[model samples]
Target: MAQNIIHLVNVSKNYNGTEALRNINLYIRKNEFLTLLGPSGCGKTTTLRIIGGFEAPDGGEVLFNGVNITSVPPYKRRVNTVFQKYALFPHLNVFENIAFGLKIKKMDKKLIAEKVHNILGLVNLSGFEQREIDSLSGGQQQRVAIARALVNEPEVLLLDEPLGALDLKLRQEMQIELKNMQQRLGITFVYVTHDQEEALSMSDTIVVMKEGSIQQIGSPIDIYNEPKNSFVADFIGESNIVSGIMLRDYLVKFAETTFECVDHGFKENEPVDVVIRPEDIQVVPAAESKLQGEVSAVTFKGVHYEMIVQNNSTRWKIQSTAMAPVGAKVGLQILPEAIHIMKKVTVK
Candidate 1:
């Protein structure tokens, strides 16, 4: 079993009378790439700050390897942080930026050079050691920031949306690169980001946060396939969420139609939320479909078409390879395994 490297036990934080993080309980496994994922003001960054010792929590404890580190100063912790801004020195070359930490520690000159060269190679910046910070591109600067944090050889690395400043194409490329680097280093990574795709693509485990609380924590596939609530279903990916009722085991009613599903365990006739991924819904002939609808809109989305189908008063977003012309009557075929049910939540 994997050991827990970090834990937040009933951690809470407040700012100016408003709650920022409410009773957050989180565990990060050793050598795992974990992401704290949510939108702005959702307290994801606050949680990261708490872990990094930048901000002391108003309540609860921060634990590292079962030891309480709530009072430990940031400099004393075995962790390093890379922020959205690279914070590289404009006058320093890449080699100096990466070696700064080691130099501060008064390490031997030879060891600093070896460590700097090794990390530069890890971030694919081997020959760029002599390059000035301003000369590097946004992606390269971000890599330098990561390399600086990593060159210290911290046990855990905290990243606060390090790729937020990069362009889309560069950000995507860096996502894969960072994941590979984390695996190669075999160190714990606690990453914070609001981008759902970025979190889903790179994390070994994702902690979904909303309004100062955690909504769900699971593997990317588990979170996508079995969202615990409507918010999680809607936040992690494009989902067709609708009000429904559990009529019985493996049976549900939505859109005024009863359908067979693979989920069970809800009370009979319990009000619930139903989620169907856009890609799971297939477009079929009206006669063969489980439900009939009119194609309201169609968009080309590179790999597939993003289409909106209206059945009565309910609208569904679907991803399909087969395009249906707007205003055409169509049928939406939903498989039993594709229908997911969750207990309904009352919106404030």
Candidate 2:
């Protein structure tokens, strides 16, 4: 079993009396790529900061290697951060920028040069040693910032939306690069981002947050396919969420029709939330299906067309290769495996 490198025990934080984190209990395993995913004000960034020792929680403790370190300063912790704004020295070249930390420790010149070159090579910038910071592109500068943080060989790396400043194409490219880099380095990564696709693409485990609290934690596939509630289903991707009743194990009633589902564990006749992904819904001829809806909208989305079908007050978003014309009656076939039943959540 992999040992946990860090743990936040009942951690809570506040900013001017408003809660930033609410009793967040989290553990980061060694050498795993974990992402804290949520929207703004969700406290993903604040969680990362707490782990990096940049911010301290108002209650509870932070543990590093099983030892309490809640009060430790940022510089003393065995972690480093890479922020959205790649904080490189404007006057310094790439070499000087990466070497600043080692030099500040008063290390020998030859050793600093060796470490700087090696780190630059890891970041694929070996030949750009003398290039000025301003001379590099956004991607290159971000690489420099990452290299500087990684050069110190911290046990964990906290990234706060580091790719938010890059263009879409470059950001996607860096996603692959960063994942590969983390695998090659064999280090723990606690990344924070509001982008769901980015979190899904690069994470081994995802912690989804909402309103300063963690909503769910699981592997990306599990989070998407088996969301704990409607909030997770609606946030992780495009989902058709509807109120339903669990008629029995493997059976549910929604849209005035009963469906055979793969989920259970709910009380008999219990009200639940049904989550069906857009792609999981199969479109068929209305005459062949018991349930039918009228096509209200159709949108071409590259490989597939997104369709909105209206059945009374319920609007279903379905994705299919074939497009049904608006006003056409279509059948939505939700297979047993595609129907995900979740416990309904009540807000206080």
Candidate 3:
């Protein structure tokens, strides 16, 4: 088996009196695109910085290819970072900006030119070598930043929200481009972002963090479909989490109704949280419904209609293609496959 490209065991970081990371343990496979996803101030950036050797840990160690690099300087580490703002020098053209690192390393001019040219082509910036930084658009600048980093042929690329500066459409375009580039080059990429959609769309594995600790780590489907806790369910996507009591191995009670969920291992009568996405709720005629509700609001979404339904005691959000008039009675149904049962955790 191939060795893991990056590893962090029991790693923690503290600033002043506040802990920024808490006992992080992870192993990143070679040539994989892994994302550190979480809300702002959730230690995602801290983890990236620690791996990049920009910040040292308070305890534990960081390893690269089984080598302990906990104390390695940033420049000596086989990693390169691309910041959100691109950070290219306005006075320097694309070629100079990308060739700066190799120049500092005293690489021969011929070698630098060859490497820079290849990277420019790799990032789709081949013809922009002499273009000034200020003369490019946000997406163009981002490409230049990526090209500059890849010019060094680092083992891993750390992108700290490199697409955050672009407009929505451009950002979406770049996401696909970035994924394609990673696959084509077969290089490891460690991306940090708070954008849940981006994480879901691009990551091979995702580490979800909150309050300086990891909430969950898994594939996009595992994190989205089988969230281990209420926080993970609520953070990764839009979920309607309802408090319920486990009746048995497969039965749960919520709002005076017993639901058959395909989840197990809960003690009888234990309080659990059930999560169902908006799109998972099926809307049917009042007389044929399993879960009856009253329509409180309805809005047209180009592809589907979003309806807010209330069960007199609780409001539930639902999405459907069938339009329902506001103030009408409707029945809500959640398939067994859509119900996610999780044990709730008290926030510290």
Candidate 4:
């Protein structure tokens, strides 16, 4: 079993009169790429800051390897942070930027040189050592920031939406690169991002948060496939969430029709929320489909068509390679496994 490198016990934070984090409990495994994922104002960055020792929690304790570090200063913790803006000094060259931490520690010049040389090679910027910060592109600057953090040889690295400044293509490329680097280095990575795709692509485990509390924590596949609630299903990916009733094991009723499903363990006649991914729905001829609807809208999404179909009063977003023109009648076929049932949320 992987050991827990960091643990947050009933951690809470408040700013002004508003609550930012409400009883957050999390455990990060050693050498795992974990992502704190949520939309803005959801406390993802606040949690990261707390873990990095930049902010103190109003309640609870932070444990690193079973040792409480709640009062430890940021500089004293064996962790480094890479901010979204990179924070590279404009006056320093790439080599100097990476070597800045070592110099602050008053390390031997030869040792700093060796460490800088090796990290530059690790980030694939071996020959760009003397290049000025302004001379590098956005992606290169991100690499320099990561290299600087890694040069400190910290046990854990905290990243605060580090790819937020990059373009779509560059951000996608960096997602893969960062995941590979984490595997190669075998160090714990606590990454913060609002981008769902980034969390899905790079994380060994994803902690999905909303409104200052965690919604779910699981592997990407698990979180994407078996969401615990409507919030998680809707946030993790494109989902068609609708009210439904579980008729029995392997049977559910939604859209005023009963359909076979692969989920069970629900009480008979229990109210639930049903989720079906856009990609899981197939468009077929209206005459052969279980549900018939008219194509209300269609958009060319490069690799596939993003289509909206209206069945009664429900609008379902579907992704398919087949182009169904608006006003055309179509059938939506969903496999049994595609039907996900979540418990309904009750309000006080």
Output the TM-score of candidate 3. Answer: 0.94
| Better model by lDDT: candidate 2 vs candidate 3 | 2
Error of 4 at 7 (Å): 0.8
Best by TM-score: 1
Global local distance difference test of model 4 = 0.92
lDDT of 4 at 102: 95
- Local accuracy by lDDT, each model: 0.92, 0.90, 0.89, 0.92
Candidate 3: misplaced stretches above 4 Å? 106-118, 121-126
Model 3, range 212-308, lDDT digits (tens) per residue? 9998999999999888898888888988889989899989888678888898998989998988899999888888866798898998989999999
**lDDT per residue, candidate 2, 156-236, as tens digits?**
999988888778987887799889889998989999898899999999999999989999999999998878889988999
lDDT of 2: 0.90
Colliding pairs, model 4: none
| Number of clashing residue pairs, candidate 4 | 0
Tens digit per residue, CA lDDT, model 1, 1-348: 899999999999999998999999999999999999988899988998899999999999999999999999999999999986668989999999999999999999999999999899877789998999999988889989999998887889999999898899878888898898889889899999988999999999999999999999999999988889989889999999999999999999999889999988899999999999999999998988769999999999999999999999799999999999999899888999999999998786
Tens digits of per-residue lDDT, candidate 4, 160-211, equal 9998878898778778877888888888999999888899989999999988
1 or 2, greater by TM-score: 1
Local error of candidate 1 at residue 29 (angstroms): 1.5
List all candidate RMSDs to the true structure. 1.6, 1.8, 1.8, 1.8
